[model samples]
Target: MRIALFVTCLNDALFPQAGIATVTVLERLGHTVAFPAAQSCCGQMHANTGYAAPARQLERLTEDAFAGQDAIVSPSGSCVAHLRAHTALPVYELSELLVDVLGVTDVGATFPHRVTYHPTCHGLRMLRLGDRPTALLRAVRGLDLVDLPEPEQCCGFGGTFALKNAAVSGAMLADKCASAASTGAEYLAAADNSCLAHIGGGLARHPGAPKPIHYAEILAATGGIRE
Candidate 1:
Protein backbone atom coordinates (compact mmCIF):
# COMPACT_ATOMS: atom_id res chain seq x y z
CA MET A 1 0.00 0.00 0.00
CA ARG A 2 1.20 3.51 -0.77
CA ILE A 3 1.14 5.55 2.45
CA ALA A 4 1.92 9.18 3.12
CA LEU A 5 3.10 10.28 6.52
CA PHE A 6 1.41 13.49 7.63
CA VAL A 7 4.03 14.58 10.06
CA THR A 8 2.15 17.38 11.75
CA CYS A 9 3.93 20.71 12.26
CA LEU A 10 4.48 20.04 15.96
CA ASN A 11 6.01 16.64 15.28
CA ASP A 12 8.15 17.96 12.45
CA ALA A 13 9.56 20.68 14.66
CA LEU A 14 9.28 19.48 18.27
CA PHE A 15 8.85 15.71 18.13
CA PRO A 16 10.67 14.53 15.05
CA GLN A 17 11.39 11.17 16.61
CA ALA A 18 7.72 10.32 16.74
CA GLY A 19 7.42 10.85 13.02
CA ILE A 20 10.55 8.85 12.40
CA ALA A 21 9.31 6.07 14.63
CA THR A 22 6.04 5.99 12.73
CA VAL A 23 7.89 5.57 9.46
CA THR A 24 10.09 2.90 10.98
CA VAL A 25 7.13 0.84 12.14
CA LEU A 26 5.32 1.12 8.81
CA GLU A 27 8.39 0.18 6.82
CA ARG A 28 9.02 -2.74 9.13
CA LEU A 29 5.55 -3.93 8.27
CA GLY A 30 6.55 -3.93 4.57
CA HIS A 31 4.57 -0.88 3.47
CA THR A 32 6.26 2.04 1.72
CA VAL A 33 5.81 5.43 3.37
CA ALA A 34 6.01 8.82 1.70
CA PHE A 35 6.65 12.27 3.14
CA PRO A 36 4.88 15.11 1.40
CA ALA A 37 6.89 18.29 1.86
CA ALA A 38 3.91 20.60 1.43
CA GLN A 39 2.13 19.32 4.53
CA SER A 40 1.56 21.83 7.38
CA CYS A 41 -0.76 22.44 10.27
CA CYS A 42 -4.30 21.08 9.83
CA GLY A 43 -5.57 24.52 10.93
CA GLN A 44 -7.21 23.01 13.99
CA MET A 45 -5.90 25.89 16.07
CA HIS A 46 -7.63 28.41 13.84
CA ALA A 47 -10.88 26.49 13.66
CA ASN A 48 -11.03 25.90 17.39
CA THR A 49 -10.34 29.59 18.07
CA GLY A 50 -13.20 30.85 15.84
CA TYR A 51 -11.14 31.60 12.76
CA ALA A 52 -13.03 29.66 10.14
CA ALA A 53 -11.71 31.25 6.98
CA PRO A 54 -8.03 30.35 7.43
CA ALA A 55 -8.87 26.97 8.83
CA ARG A 56 -10.84 26.22 5.69
CA GLN A 57 -7.95 27.35 3.53
CA LEU A 58 -5.51 25.25 5.54
CA GLU A 59 -7.83 22.30 5.33
CA ARG A 60 -7.71 22.59 1.57
CA LEU A 61 -3.95 22.79 1.60
CA THR A 62 -3.74 19.71 3.79
CA GLU A 63 -5.91 17.80 1.36
CA ASP A 64 -3.68 18.89 -1.46
CA ALA A 65 -0.56 17.86 0.41
CA PHE A 66 -1.58 14.23 0.54
CA ALA A 67 -3.66 14.14 -2.58
CA GLY A 68 -3.39 10.91 -4.60
CA GLN A 69 -1.92 8.81 -1.83
CA ASP A 70 -3.65 5.51 -1.15
CA ALA A 71 -3.93 6.48 2.49
CA ILE A 72 -2.61 9.34 4.56
CA VAL A 73 -1.40 8.27 7.98
CA SER A 74 -0.21 10.42 10.80
CA PRO A 75 1.46 9.80 14.11
CA SER A 76 -0.91 12.33 15.64
CA GLY A 77 -4.50 11.36 16.35
CA SER A 78 -5.44 14.98 17.06
CA CYS A 79 -4.34 16.21 13.65
CA VAL A 80 -5.89 13.31 11.75
CA ALA A 81 -9.16 13.76 13.64
CA HIS A 82 -9.21 17.45 12.77
CA LEU A 83 -8.54 16.90 9.10
CA ARG A 84 -11.15 14.16 8.80
CA ALA A 85 -13.74 16.77 9.73
CA HIS A 86 -13.54 18.40 6.27
CA THR A 87 -11.14 16.58 4.00
CA ALA A 88 -12.48 13.93 1.68
CA LEU A 89 -9.29 11.92 1.64
CA PRO A 90 -8.80 8.89 3.82
CA VAL A 91 -6.70 9.92 6.79
CA TYR A 92 -5.83 7.36 9.43
CA GLU A 93 -4.27 7.97 12.79
CA LEU A 94 -1.37 5.55 13.40
CA SER A 95 -3.23 3.17 15.66
CA GLU A 96 -6.32 3.30 13.50
CA LEU A 97 -4.27 2.44 10.45
CA LEU A 98 -2.42 -0.37 12.16
CA VAL A 99 -5.42 -2.01 13.75
CA ASP A 100 -8.26 -1.24 11.33
CA VAL A 101 -6.58 -1.03 7.95
CA LEU A 102 -3.40 -3.05 8.33
CA GLY A 103 -4.99 -5.66 10.58
CA VAL A 104 -1.94 -6.03 12.73
CA THR A 105 -1.05 -5.80 16.37
CA ASP A 106 2.30 -6.35 18.16
CA VAL A 107 4.28 -4.93 15.20
CA GLY A 108 7.32 -6.91 16.39
CA ALA A 109 8.03 -4.33 19.10
CA THR A 110 9.35 -4.63 22.61
CA PHE A 111 9.61 -2.03 25.36
CA PRO A 112 10.28 -3.31 28.85
CA HIS A 113 8.64 -0.50 30.77
CA ARG A 114 5.69 -0.21 33.11
CA VAL A 115 3.41 2.07 31.09
CA THR A 116 -0.05 3.62 31.32
CA TYR A 117 -2.05 4.65 28.25
CA HIS A 118 -3.90 7.96 27.92
CA PRO A 119 -6.55 8.12 25.24
CA THR A 120 -6.52 11.65 23.85
CA CYS A 121 -9.90 13.31 23.43
CA HIS A 122 -9.92 13.26 19.66
CA GLY A 123 -8.62 9.69 19.37
CA LEU A 124 -10.92 8.46 22.07
CA ARG A 125 -14.10 10.20 20.92
CA MET A 126 -13.65 11.35 17.34
CA LEU A 127 -11.77 8.29 16.15
CA ARG A 128 -13.39 5.89 18.63
CA LEU A 129 -10.07 4.05 18.75
CA GLY A 130 -11.14 1.89 21.66
CA ASP A 131 -8.66 -0.87 22.61
CA ARG A 132 -6.64 -0.49 19.42
CA PRO A 133 -3.70 1.19 21.11
CA THR A 134 -3.94 -0.87 24.26
CA ALA A 135 -4.18 -4.03 22.20
CA LEU A 136 -0.93 -3.18 20.46
CA LEU A 137 0.72 -2.32 23.76
CA ARG A 138 -0.38 -5.57 25.32
CA ALA A 139 0.95 -7.56 22.39
CA VAL A 140 4.38 -6.09 22.86
CA ARG A 141 6.71 -8.68 24.31
CA GLY A 142 7.83 -7.05 27.55
CA LEU A 143 5.67 -3.97 28.07
CA ASP A 144 3.33 -3.75 31.03
CA LEU A 145 0.09 -1.93 30.24
CA VAL A 146 -1.97 -0.50 33.10
CA ASP A 147 -5.42 1.02 33.12
CA LEU A 148 -5.68 4.78 33.52
CA PRO A 149 -8.24 6.16 35.97
CA GLU A 150 -11.14 7.84 34.20
CA PRO A 151 -9.44 7.29 30.87
CA GLU A 152 -12.16 9.26 29.13
CA GLN A 153 -11.29 12.53 30.85
CA CYS A 154 -9.49 15.18 28.87
CA CYS A 155 -5.90 16.01 29.65
CA GLY A 156 -6.57 19.79 29.62
CA PHE A 157 -4.41 20.25 26.51
CA GLY A 158 -7.31 21.00 24.27
CA GLY A 159 -5.09 23.20 22.13
CA THR A 160 -6.20 26.77 23.00
CA PHE A 161 -8.30 25.63 25.93
CA ALA A 162 -5.22 25.62 28.12
CA LEU A 163 -4.33 29.12 27.10
CA LYS A 164 -7.82 30.51 27.56
CA ASN A 165 -8.49 28.77 30.86
CA ALA A 166 -5.08 28.52 32.45
CA ALA A 167 -6.21 27.77 35.99
CA VAL A 168 -8.73 25.15 35.01
CA SER A 169 -6.27 23.59 32.59
CA GLY A 170 -3.64 23.35 35.28
CA ALA A 171 -6.02 21.71 37.70
CA MET A 172 -7.10 19.16 35.14
CA LEU A 173 -3.54 18.45 34.16
CA ALA A 174 -2.55 18.03 37.81
CA ASP A 175 -5.23 15.42 38.26
CA LYS A 176 -4.08 13.58 35.14
CA CYS A 177 -0.47 13.56 36.32
CA ALA A 178 -1.50 12.26 39.71
CA SER A 179 -3.48 9.44 38.14
CA ALA A 180 -0.59 8.54 35.86
CA ALA A 181 1.84 8.59 38.77
CA SER A 182 -0.37 6.47 40.99
CA THR A 183 0.03 3.58 38.56
CA GLY A 184 3.71 3.42 39.52
CA ALA A 185 4.60 3.28 35.86
CA GLU A 186 7.96 4.23 34.46
CA TYR A 187 6.48 5.94 31.41
CA LEU A 188 3.16 7.48 30.49
CA ALA A 189 2.22 6.49 26.93
CA ALA A 190 -0.34 8.15 24.69
CA ALA A 191 -1.08 8.53 20.99
CA ASP A 192 -1.11 12.32 21.11
CA ASN A 193 2.07 14.08 22.12
CA SER A 194 0.24 17.32 22.90
CA CYS A 195 -1.57 15.72 25.80
CA LEU A 196 1.62 14.03 26.89
CA ALA A 197 3.45 17.35 26.87
CA HIS A 198 0.85 18.97 29.06
CA ILE A 199 0.63 16.07 31.50
CA GLY A 200 4.38 15.53 31.40
CA GLY A 201 5.02 19.20 32.14
CA GLY A 202 3.03 18.97 35.34
CA LEU A 203 4.92 15.80 36.22
CA ALA A 204 8.22 17.49 35.44
CA ARG A 205 7.72 19.96 38.31
CA HIS A 206 7.94 16.99 40.65
CA PRO A 207 11.05 14.83 40.88
CA GLY A 208 11.07 11.24 39.54
CA ALA A 209 7.81 11.55 37.66
CA PRO A 210 7.05 9.17 34.83
CA LYS A 211 7.97 10.90 31.61
CA PRO A 212 5.51 10.65 28.74
CA ILE A 213 6.53 8.72 25.62
CA HIS A 214 4.70 8.68 22.34
CA TYR A 215 3.16 5.27 21.54
CA ALA A 216 4.66 5.30 18.05
CA GLU A 217 8.10 5.46 19.62
CA ILE A 218 7.29 2.36 21.60
CA LEU A 219 5.94 0.54 18.56
CA ALA A 220 9.04 1.45 16.57
CA ALA A 221 11.34 0.15 19.26
CA THR A 222 13.56 -2.94 18.72
CA GLY A 223 15.97 -2.81 21.63
CA GLY A 224 16.40 0.94 21.83
CA ILE A 225 15.80 3.30 24.74
CA ARG A 226 12.60 2.55 26.61
CA GLU A 227 11.93 6.24 27.14
Candidate 2:
Protein backbone atom coordinates (compact mmCIF):
# COMPACT_ATOMS: atom_id res chain seq x y z
CA MET A 1 0.00 0.00 0.00
CA ARG A 2 1.26 3.47 -0.86
CA ILE A 3 0.65 6.14 1.80
CA ALA A 4 1.18 9.88 1.52
CA LEU A 5 2.32 11.58 4.71
CA PHE A 6 0.62 14.86 5.49
CA VAL A 7 3.54 16.21 7.50
CA THR A 8 2.02 19.23 9.20
CA CYS A 9 3.83 22.57 9.32
CA LEU A 10 4.90 22.20 12.94
CA ASN A 11 6.25 18.71 12.31
CA ASP A 12 8.09 19.90 9.25
CA ALA A 13 9.59 22.78 11.20
CA LEU A 14 10.25 21.36 14.66
CA PHE A 15 9.42 17.66 14.80
CA PRO A 16 10.76 16.21 11.58
CA GLN A 17 11.83 13.08 13.42
CA ALA A 18 8.19 12.13 13.91
CA GLY A 19 7.58 12.42 10.18
CA ILE A 20 10.72 10.42 9.44
CA ALA A 21 9.67 7.77 11.92
CA THR A 22 6.22 7.56 10.36
CA VAL A 23 7.86 6.82 7.03
CA THR A 24 10.23 4.30 8.58
CA VAL A 25 7.47 2.40 10.37
CA LEU A 26 5.27 2.33 7.28
CA GLU A 27 8.15 1.05 5.13
CA ARG A 28 8.85 -1.59 7.79
CA LEU A 29 5.26 -2.72 7.35
CA GLY A 30 5.91 -3.11 3.60
CA HIS A 31 4.07 0.11 2.66
CA THR A 32 5.51 2.95 0.59
CA VAL A 33 5.40 6.45 2.09
CA ALA A 34 5.33 9.65 0.07
CA PHE A 35 5.89 13.19 1.26
CA PRO A 36 3.62 15.73 -0.38
CA ALA A 37 5.92 18.78 -0.30
CA ALA A 38 3.23 21.13 -1.47
CA GLN A 39 1.47 20.63 1.87
CA SER A 40 1.51 23.55 4.29
CA CYS A 41 -0.42 24.52 7.35
CA CYS A 42 -3.92 23.03 7.44
CA GLY A 43 -5.05 26.45 8.64
CA GLN A 44 -5.66 25.07 12.10
CA MET A 45 -3.86 28.00 13.71
CA HIS A 46 -5.74 30.48 11.55
CA ALA A 47 -9.11 28.83 12.12
CA ASN A 48 -8.53 28.56 15.85
CA THR A 49 -7.53 32.22 15.96
CA GLY A 50 -10.70 33.27 14.12
CA TYR A 51 -9.29 33.81 10.62
CA ALA A 52 -11.96 32.10 8.58
CA ALA A 53 -10.86 33.18 5.12
CA PRO A 54 -7.25 32.13 5.48
CA ALA A 55 -8.29 28.82 7.01
CA ARG A 56 -10.52 28.07 4.03
CA GLN A 57 -7.74 28.99 1.63
CA LEU A 58 -5.37 26.62 3.41
CA GLU A 59 -8.01 23.93 3.35
CA ARG A 60 -8.12 24.18 -0.42
CA LEU A 61 -4.33 24.21 -0.66
CA THR A 62 -4.13 21.16 1.60
CA GLU A 63 -6.67 19.35 -0.53
CA ASP A 64 -4.57 20.04 -3.60
CA ALA A 65 -1.36 18.85 -1.90
CA PHE A 66 -2.27 15.19 -1.82
CA ALA A 67 -4.88 15.14 -4.55
CA GLY A 68 -4.14 11.68 -5.90
CA GLN A 69 -3.01 9.63 -2.93
CA ASP A 70 -5.09 6.57 -2.07
CA ALA A 71 -4.27 6.95 1.64
CA ILE A 72 -3.26 10.06 3.62
CA VAL A 73 -1.60 9.51 6.99
CA SER A 74 -0.31 12.00 9.52
CA PRO A 75 1.49 11.53 12.79
CA SER A 76 -0.60 14.32 14.24
CA GLY A 77 -4.11 13.54 15.43
CA SER A 78 -4.81 17.27 15.93
CA CYS A 79 -4.09 18.17 12.31
CA VAL A 80 -5.84 15.05 11.04
CA ALA A 81 -8.94 15.90 13.09
CA HIS A 82 -8.96 19.42 11.67
CA LEU A 83 -8.74 18.11 8.10
CA ARG A 84 -11.13 15.18 8.59
CA ALA A 85 -13.95 17.58 9.40
CA HIS A 86 -13.41 19.61 6.25
CA THR A 87 -11.93 17.40 3.53
CA ALA A 88 -13.66 14.82 1.36
CA LEU A 89 -10.26 13.09 1.13
CA PRO A 90 -9.49 10.23 3.49
CA VAL A 91 -7.14 11.28 6.32
CA TYR A 92 -6.02 8.87 9.00
CA GLU A 93 -4.00 9.48 12.14
CA LEU A 94 -0.92 7.24 12.41
CA SER A 95 -2.49 4.90 14.93
CA GLU A 96 -5.85 4.90 13.14
CA LEU A 97 -4.24 3.99 9.83
CA LEU A 98 -1.95 1.39 11.37
CA VAL A 99 -4.66 -0.31 13.36
CA ASP A 100 -7.90 0.35 11.50
CA VAL A 101 -6.78 0.50 7.86
CA LEU A 102 -3.70 -1.72 7.86
CA GLY A 103 -5.01 -4.22 10.41
CA VAL A 104 -1.67 -4.32 12.25
CA THR A 105 -0.50 -2.87 15.55
CA ASP A 106 2.93 -4.31 16.15
CA VAL A 107 5.41 -2.53 13.95
CA GLY A 108 8.36 -4.68 15.08
CA ALA A 109 9.51 -2.13 17.67
CA THR A 110 11.14 -2.65 21.04
CA PHE A 111 11.71 -0.10 23.82
CA PRO A 112 12.49 -1.48 27.28
CA HIS A 113 11.35 1.49 29.28
CA ARG A 114 8.29 2.29 31.35
CA VAL A 115 6.21 4.82 29.45
CA THR A 116 2.90 6.65 29.86
CA TYR A 117 0.73 8.00 27.05
CA HIS A 118 -0.84 11.47 27.17
CA PRO A 119 -3.90 11.44 24.92
CA THR A 120 -4.11 14.99 23.58
CA CYS A 121 -7.48 16.75 23.45
CA HIS A 122 -7.77 16.36 19.68
CA GLY A 123 -6.78 12.68 19.68
CA LEU A 124 -8.89 11.93 22.73
CA ARG A 125 -12.09 13.81 22.02
CA MET A 126 -11.87 14.94 18.41
CA LEU A 127 -10.49 11.77 16.84
CA ARG A 128 -11.71 9.40 19.58
CA LEU A 129 -8.51 7.31 19.34
CA GLY A 130 -9.24 5.44 22.52
CA ASP A 131 -6.75 2.67 23.33
CA ARG A 132 -5.35 2.55 19.80
CA PRO A 133 -2.05 4.07 20.88
CA THR A 134 -2.02 2.03 24.05
CA ALA A 135 -2.76 -1.15 22.12
CA LEU A 136 0.12 -0.49 19.76
CA LEU A 137 2.48 0.27 22.65
CA ARG A 138 1.39 -2.96 24.37
CA ALA A 139 2.43 -4.89 21.30
CA VAL A 140 5.94 -3.43 21.34
CA ARG A 141 8.36 -6.05 22.52
CA GLY A 142 9.88 -5.37 26.00
CA LEU A 143 7.89 -2.15 26.43
CA ASP A 144 6.17 -1.59 29.74
CA LEU A 145 3.22 0.66 29.15
CA VAL A 146 1.90 2.35 32.27
CA ASP A 147 -1.47 3.93 32.80
CA LEU A 148 -1.51 7.71 32.91
CA PRO A 149 -3.19 8.93 36.12
CA GLU A 150 -5.59 11.10 34.14
CA PRO A 151 -5.12 10.10 30.55
CA GLU A 152 -8.01 12.20 29.31
CA GLN A 153 -6.70 15.51 30.64
CA CYS A 154 -5.31 17.98 28.15
CA CYS A 155 -1.63 18.97 28.28
CA GLY A 156 -2.76 22.58 27.78
CA PHE A 157 -1.21 22.97 24.32
CA GLY A 158 -4.19 24.16 22.28
CA GLY A 159 -1.98 25.80 19.69
CA THR A 160 -2.15 29.50 20.60
CA PHE A 161 -3.94 28.75 23.82
CA ALA A 162 -0.59 28.49 25.58
CA LEU A 163 0.49 31.87 24.28
CA LYS A 164 -2.82 33.60 25.01
CA ASN A 165 -3.34 32.04 28.41
CA ALA A 166 0.17 31.45 29.68
CA ALA A 167 -0.51 31.23 33.40
CA VAL A 168 -3.45 28.88 33.07
CA SER A 169 -1.61 26.76 30.57
CA GLY A 170 1.43 26.55 32.80
CA ALA A 171 -0.65 25.46 35.77
CA MET A 172 -2.39 22.79 33.75
CA LEU A 173 0.97 21.61 32.44
CA ALA A 174 2.27 21.46 35.98
CA ASP A 175 -0.51 19.09 36.91
CA LYS A 176 0.14 16.94 33.85
CA CYS A 177 3.88 16.81 34.53
CA ALA A 178 3.27 15.77 38.11
CA SER A 179 0.92 13.04 36.99
CA ALA A 180 3.39 11.67 34.47
CA ALA A 181 6.20 11.80 37.03
CA SER A 182 4.15 9.85 39.56
CA THR A 183 3.79 7.01 37.10
CA GLY A 184 7.54 6.34 37.49
CA ALA A 185 7.74 6.21 33.76
CA GLU A 186 11.02 7.23 32.18
CA TYR A 187 9.25 8.58 29.13
CA LEU A 188 6.13 10.65 28.59
CA ALA A 189 4.61 9.79 25.23
CA ALA A 190 1.85 11.38 23.19
CA ALA A 191 0.56 11.42 19.60
CA ASP A 192 0.98 15.19 19.30
CA ASN A 193 4.30 17.02 19.81
CA SER A 194 2.46 20.27 20.44
CA CYS A 195 1.23 18.71 23.66
CA LEU A 196 4.58 17.05 24.25
CA ALA A 197 6.35 20.37 23.81
CA HIS A 198 4.18 21.88 26.51
CA ILE A 199 4.50 18.95 28.90
CA GLY A 200 8.16 18.45 28.08
CA GLY A 201 8.86 22.12 28.73
CA GLY A 202 7.56 21.79 32.26
CA LEU A 203 9.49 18.55 32.73
CA ALA A 204 12.70 20.24 31.63
CA ARG A 205 12.62 22.68 34.57
CA HIS A 206 12.98 19.87 37.05
CA PRO A 207 15.98 17.55 37.34
CA GLY A 208 15.58 13.98 36.09
CA ALA A 209 12.15 14.52 34.55
CA PRO A 210 10.85 12.09 31.99
CA LYS A 211 11.52 13.12 28.42
CA PRO A 212 8.54 13.59 26.16
CA ILE A 213 8.59 11.45 23.01
CA HIS A 214 6.16 11.18 20.13
CA TYR A 215 4.43 7.79 19.74
CA ALA A 216 5.75 7.33 16.21
CA GLU A 217 9.34 7.60 17.46
CA ILE A 218 8.63 4.76 19.82
CA LEU A 219 6.92 2.64 17.20
CA ALA A 220 9.78 3.26 14.83
CA ALA A 221 12.33 2.12 17.37
CA THR A 222 14.49 -0.83 16.39
CA GLY A 223 15.24 -3.10 19.34
CA GLY A 224 15.81 -0.84 22.40
CA ILE A 225 16.93 2.25 20.46
CA ARG A 226 14.41 5.10 20.08
CA GLU A 227 14.50 7.19 16.93
TM-score of every candidate relative to the true structure: 0.97, 0.98
Residue 203 CA displacement from its true place in model 2, Å: 0.5
lDDT of 1 by residue, 1-227 (tens): 88999999888889888999999999999999999989888998889889999999999999888889989999889888888887898999998899999999979998888889999999889989999999998988788888888888898989888999999998899888888888888888999888888998898987777888999999998774732
CA displacement after TM-score superposition, residue 128 of candidate 1 (Å): 0.7
| CA shift of 157, model 1, Å | 1.4
Top-lDDT candidate index? 2
Residues 83-142, candidate 2: write the lDDT tens digits: 999888789999999999999988999998888889999999999999999999999988
- How many residue pairs clash in all the candidates, one count each? 0, 0
lDDT of 2: 0.90
